[model samples]
Target chain A: MIEFKNVSKVYPNGVKALNNINLFIDKGEFLVIIGLSGAGKSTLLRLINQLIPVSTGQVIVDGVRMDTASGKILRNMRRKIGMIFQSFNIVKRMSVLSNVLSGRVGYHPTWRNVLGIYPEDDKQIAYKALQRVDILEKVHNRASDLSGGQQQRVAIARALAQQPLIMLADEPVASLDPITTVQVMDFLKEICASDGITTVANLHHVDLAWKYATRVVGVRAGEIVYDQRPSQTTKNQFIKDMEIVYGRPIHHDEFVIEEAVV
Target chain B: MSDRIIVPPPKRLGQTLGILTVILVIVASAIFARFNIIEVILGLQRGGRILARMFPLPGWFGPLMETLQMAVTGTFWGALLAFPIAILSARNIVDVPWIRVPLRFFLNILRTIPAMVFAAMFVAIFGIGNFSGVIALVIFSFGLVAKLLFESIEAIDEGQVEALRSLGADTLTVIRYAVLPQILPQYISYTLYAFEINVRSAAVLGYVGAGGIGQLFERALAWRRFHEVGELVIVSFVVVLFLDFFSAKVRRSLI
Candidate 1:
């Protein structure tokens, strides 16, 4: 379980990225945080992993309080939380298998990892993760050689290789085409469902949130304005709630046309 | 649109001509002081006679081989030493300002001294041989290679580095997996570039009794054997050209 108690983030220049927000994410839940650009969706997701440290309040992950965690404890905490970035973040010059193998570095000694001497079991795990993403065929290819969608799949495989307790994705599909976006989202959804890993994703498209998220949380101006289960959400009510989050009425044209078709 | 608003072409042309006149005057003054066309014309006849004497080259193939050997050894050791220095100087890999700053300053100081001066100093201290020449080239190559490699390191995508860090990889692992792979080709290319420079510098290192074909040239000149000196110069040119061709081929394959 991930628990946020009065979490707030104030930047050095004094722009509040997140307000004193309290929330709880149950284990195995597929949660999607939605907002406009710069609405703190990314910040909230990053705070869970302590990627961007919280300026105030406590974030307790599993049993460790991240705000106070330091040195080895902090690293240990990060090892269990796998993060996926919008840009894929795979090292372009490295092979796909090596990029996936990197996710296991935390488990090995520093010298071992530096020499890239992962155990046979670790290699098997990496291969398994690639299989899960259906990108096993590209295992020996350089990350840059793959197309954007393939690279994103490789990124997913890398995260899965971590065997993380919690998966954090920050706008993972924002740069992908529509078909690839849906495919990537389905892969993420499947990973969460099958592995029972708690997944938190920051999404820009409202329809995608409704389609895949079990629970949806809305943020506006650094504050959570709405949080609800997808089944209980009415389309009109969701749009009405978005007014506070967006500071304006949600336009019909902004909704994904494919979601309407479905 | 108004007739009164029409600009005079002659006035604009005069302004341009005035600027051109000033530039021409400066060029003329610089050429007169530095080049002196009349003196160059007067000296050409004497140069022709010297050139006539330099024809029909004598073979000093043995000294030529010695020069090539010196350059190869110096560049080999210099490039080898540059590897660790370059890695330590990378900002992402070496976080401590105390270490990074001092190492960077040391590299800067190494580069600031010309290679010939380094050879001269080593000759004075170690008393003249290929050893001094090799040491000079090593220091020179280290400065060039490390500077280029560190700058390339700084320009790498920080995203990959962050990804490794998030995976809980230690500093060394991050460098190996994230930093090294991206910069390796560029590093090799830079080392080769440094090698090309070292070859030329090594040729001249023998001027200070650092031992190479340059010693032969110096000896021949002292004895007024311009023919032998001319042969050595021709041999040096051929060797340098051959090395340049090989270096270019290697660099082409690396990138």
Candidate 2:
């Protein structure tokens, strides 16, 4: 379980990125955070892994106090949390297998990873991760040669290789086309459910959030405005209610019509 | 549309004045330095005779070959030294301001001094030999490679580094798995480019008694062996040309 108690994050420049945030995330729950461009959604995701430190209160992950973890403790904490980015941050020049194996860097000695020497089991784990993501055929190909959608799959495989308990995806599908977006999001949702890993994703698309989220948490100007499941309100009412979170009405195009998705 | 049209382009007075001032300074300096156009014409006429004597060469191959050797050896060692220093000096990689600052300061000083000056200084300390020449070239190219390479290192896509860090990889592991792979091609390209430059500079280092073909050039000049001097120049020119061609191809392939 991940719990945030009165978490307030203030940047060095004094921007209140998160304001008195109180939340709890259970294992195997797929939570999607929705907000405007500067609504502090990404900050909230980064804070979980201590990528961004909370200014006040505490972040306790799986019964360990993450805010105070240092050195080995901090690294060990980071190892169990897999995060993917909007840009699909796989090293372009490396073979897809190597990029996936890089996710295993925390488990091995520095010399072994540096020299590209890995135990057979780690290679097997990487291959399996790729296989799970359905990109095993591209394992030996350079990451750069893959298309954006394929590359994002490679990034997912890398994160899976970590065997993480929590997966944080910060706008994972923002850069992808609509079709690729649906495919990647589906893959992510299926993997999280099967592995029983809690996932927190920041998504600007209301329809995607509504479709994929088991529960949706709304953040606006760095504070939680609405937190509920899809069943709490009908799709139409929730769409109208999202105005308070966005400070404006949702556009017609923004609505994820069931037909478009189907 | 009228409101948009009302806005005028920025004035060119400052730019025009700046261009005019640069031209004025160049002209003034040329006049102040005697602007000897006639002397240059007459000097080229004399230079033609010297070029003419260089054909049907005699005993010029040995020292010319030695000079080529010095550049190759020096560039090899210098490039090796440059790799770590380049990594350390890149501000993006080394978070500590103290380390990058002092290292850049030293690199600046090294770069400011020419390769020939290094050869001269080393010759005074090590005496006339290929050792001094090679050492001088090493220091010279080390600075060149480090300066060029650190900038490329800094320009690398930092997203890969952050990804490695997110995976719980430490600093050195981040460099090996993340930074090195991205910058390796650029680093090799810079080293090859430095070698191309070093070969040309190495041919001149013999004037300072730092060894190689420069010593032969100096000896032939002293004895008025104009033909021999011509031979050395041709050999040196061809060797430099060949090295430039070879290294350029290597750099192109590397990048």
Candidate 3:
């Protein structure tokens, strides 16, 4: 289990991004955090991986106190938790295979990875991950030559090749078209189900959250306001509950038209 | 749609004043330096008379070859040394201010010392020869290529670096994967650009007893052999022009 105990984060400029957040996530749960822009959803998700250092309180991950860990220990924890960004930050100058193989760098010696001496087994793993994401044919292609959707798939394959225990996606589909959005979301959902990986995603569209989330946690002004299963949530609740989060009622366009019937 | 934004014209007060000041300074400096157009015109006339004897450039093989050899050797080693210097100087790659600060300060100090000054120093240390010229050119190239390359590194897409970090990459691995690939082409182009410039600089390095075409030119001038000096100038000009063309083409392909 992942636990955040009275965790708080305040920026150097005194802007509080998270406040006294105590939460628990089970091993195989698919949790989606939804909030308005800068509503602390990203902060809360990042806290799990210790990407953003906690200003106060303790963050215990699988019984290790991550807040006090340093150097290699922290990096070891981070390697097991795969994170993807909105921009699909793949190195454009590299081939797709090299990009995926980069995910395995943490597993080897520093000098080995620096020299780009990937063992045959790692290459096999990278290939299998690419195949899983259905982008194996583009393995030799430069990342810059790929389409937006294809790039995200490549990002996903890179994360998968890490063999991470948990997956965190920060608005993975915000840049993608509607058709490709569904396709990428389906792949993530399928991966979470098959691997039983604890998945946490920050989603913008309300309908997308409702479709994918086993549990939805709403954050507003650095605090969790709504935490419930989708069966217990309604359209009116999405507005009334998120009004404090968004500083207004949720708009219509924020919901995808083709909402999945889960 | 109807409410069009009216853009105001740029206020040129500063620019106008700046141009006026520049012109005023130039005129004042020229006058202060005893500006004499008649003397300059007479000098140009004498230069033309000297230039008329330079047809069919002389066989400048000996000194010309020395200059080329010095530039090539200096540039090869200088370009090689610049890689590590650039990596250490780049702010994104080396976050420690102490390391980067000292490296940048040293590079600035090296660059501030002109190539002629370096050649003189090398001549003092190693005595008059092509070795001193090569040393001077090597120092010049190292400073220049490192400065340009680090700036390119700083301007690269930093998101790739962060991505490598997310993969638990070490500092060296991050540099190899993220920073190297993005900046390699630009670094190579800059090195070639430096080589093109080095050839021109090497020609004058012989002035300080650093050995090159300048030594031959110096000897020819000492003897008042205007025709021989003219021949040397023509040959040097042709070689520099050809190197510039070839390097320009190569740099274009690199970028």
Number of the top candidate by lDDT? Answer: 2
- Show model 1 residue runs off by greater than 4 Å: A260-262, B1-66, B69-73, B80-90
Ranking by lDDT: 2, 3, 1
Instruction: Pick the winner on TM-score between candidates 1 and 2.
Output: 2
- What does candidate 3's lDDT look like per residue over B98-126, in tens digits? 88999999999998988889999989999
lDDT of 3 at B101: 93
Q: What lDDT tens digits, residue by residue, belong to model 3 across residues A1-262?
A: 6888998999999999999998888898899988888889888877777767899988887677888876788778878888888899898988898899999988988888888889878878888888878888887888999999999999999989889988989899999988898889999989878998889999987778877889888888888887888767785675567666566777766665464443
Cα distance off (Å), candidate 2, residue A132:
1.0
Q: Could you give me the TM-score of model 3 versus the true structure?
A: 0.84
Model 1 per-residue lDDT tens digits across residues A1-262? 9999999999899999999999999999999999889989988987887767899999999989988887678877888888888888899988888899999988888888877888767777888888888888787787899998899899888888889999999899998888888888889999878999999999888878888889999998899998988789787787677777677887877765375443
Model 1 chain B is weakest, by summed lDDT over 10 consecutive residues, at B1-10
- Compared with the real two-chain complex, what DockQ does model 2 have? 0.23
- Which order, best to worst by DockQ? 1, 2, 3
Quote the positional error of residue A167 for candidate 1 in Å.
Answer: 0.6
For all predictions, the C-alpha RMSD in Å is 18.7, 17.7, 17.3
> Could you give candidate 2's per-residue lDDT for residues A63-176 as a string of tens digits?
999888877888888889998999888999898989999999989888888898987677778878888789888877889999999999999999999999999999999989
Off by over 4 Å in 2: A256-262, B1-58
What are the fnat scores of the candidates, in the order listed? 0.64, 0.61, 0.59
